[model samples]
Target chain A: MSTLAFLGEFGEAIQFIFEGETTREGTQVGGSQFLELTVEHIKVSVVAMVVACALAIPLGLWLGHIRRGSFLAISLSNVGRAVPSLALIAFFVAYLGVGFTNVTLALVLLAIPPILTNAYVGVTQVHRETVDAARGMGMTEARIALRVELPLALPLIFGGIKTSAVNVIATATIAPLAGVTTLGDAIINVSGYGDVGRLAAAISVAALAVMTELTLGAAQRAVTPRGIRLESGRPSRRRTLSTRIGRTASP
Target chain B: MVASAVAALTAPLAQVQLRDRSGGDAGCVADDGLCPGWIADNFDRYVDPLVQHVYLVLASVAIGFAISFALALVAHRHRWMIAPIVQVTGILYTLPSIAVFFLLLPLTGRGSLTAIVALVAYSLLIIFRNITTGLDNVPEEARDAGRGMGLTDRQLLWRVELPLALPEIMAGLRIATTTTVGLATLAFFAGAGGLGGQIFADINFKSNVVVAGGLAVLLAAVLDAAILLAQRAITPWTRARAA
Candidate 1:
């Protein structure tokens, strides 16, 4: 295709997406019609993240507090990385039947490992002296975990959440296959929307993923304690090395 | 309430399938509800797509590693380049794979080229970050010792820096390999065949879904193990030191 013609076609697709027009076959499409699909995408992602956080956070905190089951926690993170989201969705759809619930359940599974691993790592990495001091101060075990470890661990925990949220949003684009209409509907139903629709869908989904990442990344930074943030922000040799390891190792 | 909403949404699609099935072969009545016989009958069909899938992953990861390695080298030298490069790759990483597949379709057409392009783009962040980190973590004393021997920059990098960075580089490769394998499942959308195509083709079939989905999981596990073995082989000195 000529560059000019390609640019024209791209522009037209973007217009079609934002302006919302009927197809040549008199079918209503695009524009506000995509709002419903976007909402569906968010609904599935939110539910999955919520379920993942609920299950992973408390368990991860408890395990990290006890400093046990490091092997299980690490292995589960590895296995989670190995399993493809498409395979999980297909597995669920085959057994559970196609529906929103099935897709959400699969996404929940996808979101869990990162959250769990980060939560565990965060609490376990807290300084022993801090916890000891809390103990010496007559703090109970529960109080120590809550008042001491949890606060210290918040940054890594939030890092895990950010990763999970981004991953869940990206993976949710495939929910249409399970009969849950999301932004993927435009891409999947090629006969209805054509290549133009597919392009528009891709643009929207990419925008959504990037936006979600930016938003959550900011949230993560905001939640980090000021003193720790100052320490981490300054690029000391040890800090840089640990940060790099943490970034690659966790998600 | 959510359960009811799901059921309501699935009803029409189920009815449509039922109507279509009325005219098709009745394969659901098989024993044990698994239809292993169906798999046995059609086992040959999966071979071509599986090969295509593996080919797609290998080509993309190889190309991705080369590009990322070069970029990491440049960033390592300049230092200022790392942040911008990481940000660019992060954006690429965030782009949805299916969208990327279709977006490239207009330019590259529907084939393995488009699929490989998207897969390569997806891998840059992981591989590049790892390589840069590996290079940065090289001991200052080792670099000074190499310098004391009057080695040129090229020799220093090849002898002192890269050897020390091998573990982190291998870690990145392992991650990139497994991730690309997972993402390549969606390449079928671009007409580049894989196990995902097989699963999608017969999503409702127990035997087909099991075989194809199981294969994808198996492929990931096998690739991960292979990388681990390669890392061990290449980093034999580390093992010797530990022993």
Candidate 2:
């Protein structure tokens, strides 16, 4: 019955895609169908991203201010960046098994590094003069960082978050492989057939993903305070070597 | 320093020792006979595809850079093409790899060609934007000087703008290569080529010794090292500036 319907729908598949098509599995493919799937993907990804930001931003700021854990913090973030998300996904699947929770965990793991790295880099790279000036004015350490370093670091840190968000959103397409409903399903569903309809649907969803990525990116850009430029001076000599190591050791 | 030294020396080693002694529970790398040998043998299977993967990345980057350069040059001259071009590529970027794979699968089938085409598309935007940025960074005075000296536009671009743009171009290339290498893992899903094949094969079996996790790590390390070396080679300005 489903095959018959599929064949019936097949004639007008391209035209019918936006409207739903009923298949053998009793599943319907349409705009609402895609919308629901996309929403799910977005929700899972966003939640993970938010969690990552929550943990990463404060920790990143703190780590960035202190000189001691700079190496470790940087290195940890690098591992997050350096390791392939798929590899981590696979490792997560191995340990946690396949599910939304597992996939989300993998994504969160992937997401945290960039946010942490960027935030840390941004704060640490804050102009020493600016920091000194704040300190000279008798601002507390916390106040100095929150008022001075964080605002200056905002653009770069946000850039990292934006990059990570795009990455995770794109990666979330893989969620379907583990039996989660996502935009990834659009790709996997069309694997057996040579039909371009599924491919088109997949492409459409990916476009949506990219659109969301860009929208968030634009938001970050719009909010970026213009004063920050790449700090011209090299990091302290000790920091320079560690930064190199940190970059290589992780992402 | 002392506290960190103690933590560093003890923590990781203790964790490994604990996991090893515990035997079966560690998520990665199991204690089995001939794990290293199994990894070595599988790593051998990877050599050909790895070369192809490298070739694919280098070719895509070279081709993409050239294509983007031409586009950037035209767009720069025309001015109006910039927004539209960025918009189109931005759209292209959001399209997932799987979507690209399946979309091209009809025209190209499950071949390395499909991967190459997708990779080239992916590289396009990065290189294009970077090229334009680098070109834009060339000072107006420099362009005026070239004009006053009676240099042709082509000569000016080739001799002056390109040299100034070299570091930025190399940075874009570095990003392109790394992105391509990572994306190449998706090629394995198509069953055509790359180290992803070995990784997937082991993944399917859930066997650690056979899977060669260490080889994958090594492969990543080597690829990263290659990029670092390439970055230094291509951007002598960075090194000279550092000195």
Q: Per-residue lDDT for A217 in model 2?
A: 73
* Candidates 1 onward: DockQ, in order: 0.34, 0.12
- What would the per-residue lDDT of candidate 2 be over residues B1-243, giving only the tens digit for each residue? 334323432322121111121233333345333344444434455567667666766777778888888898898788778778877876666566656765564446556787888888887877777766677667789899989999998899888888877766665666566667667766654434665554444443344312433334455557657767876786677688889
Clashing pairs in 1: none
Q: After superposition, how far is residue B182 of candidate 2 from its true place, in Å?
A: 0.8
DockQ, candidate no. 2: 0.12
Q: A233, model 2: CA deviation in Å? A: 25
For candidate 2, the TM-score of chain A alone relative to the native chain A: 0.79
lDDT of 2 by residue, A102-152 (tens): 888888888887788878878887778989999999999999878888887
User: Using alpha carbons, what is the TM-score of model 2?
Assistant: 0.73
- Per-candidate alpha-carbon RMSD to the true structure: 6.5, 12.3
- The regions of model 1 sitting more than 4 angstroms off are A237-251, B1-32
